[model samples]
Target: MITADKFLIPARELGFNFFTGTPCSYLKPFINYVIDTDGFDFVDSVNEGDAIAIAAGATVGGKRAVVMFQNSGLGNAVNPITSLTYTFNIPVMIITTLRGEPGGPADEPQHELMGQITTAMLETMRLKWAFFPQTEEEVAPALKAADEYMKKHNQPFVFVMRKDDIAEYKLQKKPAASKKDFSITHTDHFELDYKARTTRTPVLEVLQKSVALSAAVIATTGKTGREFYEVGDQKNQLYMVGSMGCALAFGLGLAMVKPKLKVIVLDGDGALLMRTGSMATAGAYKPKNLVHILIDNEAHDSTGGQGTVTGGVSFGTIAAGFGYDKIYSTDRLEKFSEIVEEVKKNDVVTFVHMKTQKGSPEKLGRPKVTPAEVSVRFAEFVQSK
Candidate 1:
């Protein structure tokens, strides 16, 4: 078999230096190697989908990122893979371990069905994939093919790795000490007038004018993005369409890779609830450039205005528990504008939970710019010095 460095060194030479993924036994060596290596950055994501989103963010920030996870968790990654990467035409390399090889090994009962259909699943997702390189001689050609395809199509390429592809390598780096001391500041200015509170349009207007042109804004799916697009579209703004809960994670990834760029995530209550684990990830990494702004209308405005469970949920406290450096809660548009302006001046992982009325502007329309076009321009804006 080949050493982990055999493939990784070449991958690094080709600009694949940023890595993020969940653990798989088959991928342990690769992950360990990356963790121990001096030039690589590895983020252990909470789930497979978050891993893909994080890697996509890094890719958008002009870094060649690689995501690795077990095939069992590939199901978890399907949402972002299809909606985020495929729709946006953002290319990131994915290495998924084949845990349940049908005829090759007598495996656990859980892996049987997934092992049989792993390759088929990849094909169904319209993801071009190949069996991972098995020999030293195969590594170069395999990476070349994947790299060429990704560069040409601007879509993700997968490598389904079987067990024993790489020689075992133990991780040498020490785990980071747990963060025991941290503070969260909550500024509550809610008047508790749900109907009288400001709607999304005015909030979007304030954000449009408040956010600096140098900062990158990522709006979560649904009315938030639509309203923001309606307010005004800019080169620095990315209107997320289908990846409902990934805005924060994507912003975190971009913030990590592009430390100089301020990454703002305009999140919705429903979408934020869908992947609250991302907050914990953000808390752990604590990217100083991330600004998470949650407009909690307490209803899913895009989906027929269904009421969500966030009415009683205190997201500022949640952000505090999740380790955000700064937290602000408010219902007034003026206070929110102040918070935005305040956070823009400082480099801190900040969260603003704004309570707004649950409604949309009349006949709100979607963005005319396609997701692919937005991604291209957003990436260019991110890469600009």
Candidate 2:
């Protein structure tokens, strides 16, 4: 067996310094090693799928990220792995432990079937994976192969670790950013009819003008991104074509790695409500550079104007409860722009909720650029500074 450092040190040297995962017993040593190391970030995620989305965000922000989990939970990660990461051409490293090796050991019944089909499942997903390195000499070559494949394909690579592959390493101290003692603080409520308020189009317009040229704007799927693309397209803007509710987490991941850049997430009510858990994840990380903008038209405007429950929902209060340091909500366009300028200068994670009317331009067009092309240009822009 090899020490966890045997592979991780090299990975870190190669700039894979961000890590997130849902833990497994076999991952104890490796996960502990990553947490104990300085300059490496390890966020214990709520689930495997969200972990992948977070890594995708970090990858988009020009930082290589690694995610670790149990092989059995790979099923939980399929959606984002296929839709979000694959669709956007984001590359990340996945280290999953094999719990029930076929015919090698008698283990828990739950892990047996998963182990039998793990390798095959990965192949089906078109993920090229290698057995996790077992010795000091094997680590370098394994990592090199992963690095080359990820760089070439701009997609995820995997290392399937087996039982006892890593020698035990005890965590020396409580990690500096270890889970904290926390509580949610709700925002003050305000009743307003967005019918008399601004619509989605001008909100995009104001955002296009307020942020710096170097700032990155990640708009959620559906009409929100379409409207932004219609307003203006730039290298700094990434119009998320799929993975509907992942925009905020994606923006959070980017903000975490590239803290100097202003990263704004334009999320819609339907999308935000779909993945409400992501708000907690974003709030937990609390990246000062991230500005989460939720525009509530109280409907899924892209899908025949179906109404959402956001009319009675106060997202600013919910975001505050999730731990955003600053919260702003507006029914007026001028007030929204003022909050944008104010939050741009505030060194804290902030949330802006805008009440808008349900409507778009008569001819709002989809982004002309393909998904891969958008990803490449966005990556280049993120790395330029």
Best by TM-score: 1
For model 1, the superposed segments whose C-alpha errors exceed 4 Å read 179-189
lDDT of candidate 2 over 9-126, digit per residue (tens): 9999999999998998889998999888897998777778778988998888788899999998999788788888898888999998898889776789999899999999899999
For all predicted structures, in order, the TM-scores are 0.97, 0.92
Give candidate 1's whole-model lDDT: 0.92
Pairs with steric clashes in candidate 1:
none
lDDT of 1 at 209: 91
Error of 1 at 353 (Å): 0.3
Q: What is the number of backbone collisions in each predicted candidate, taken in the order shown?
A: 0, 0
| Collision pairs in model 2 | none
TM-score, predicted candidate 1 vs. hidden true structure: 0.97
Q: What is the lDDT of residue 229 in candidate 2?
A: 87
lDDT per prediction? Answer: 0.92, 0.87
TM-score of 2: 0.92
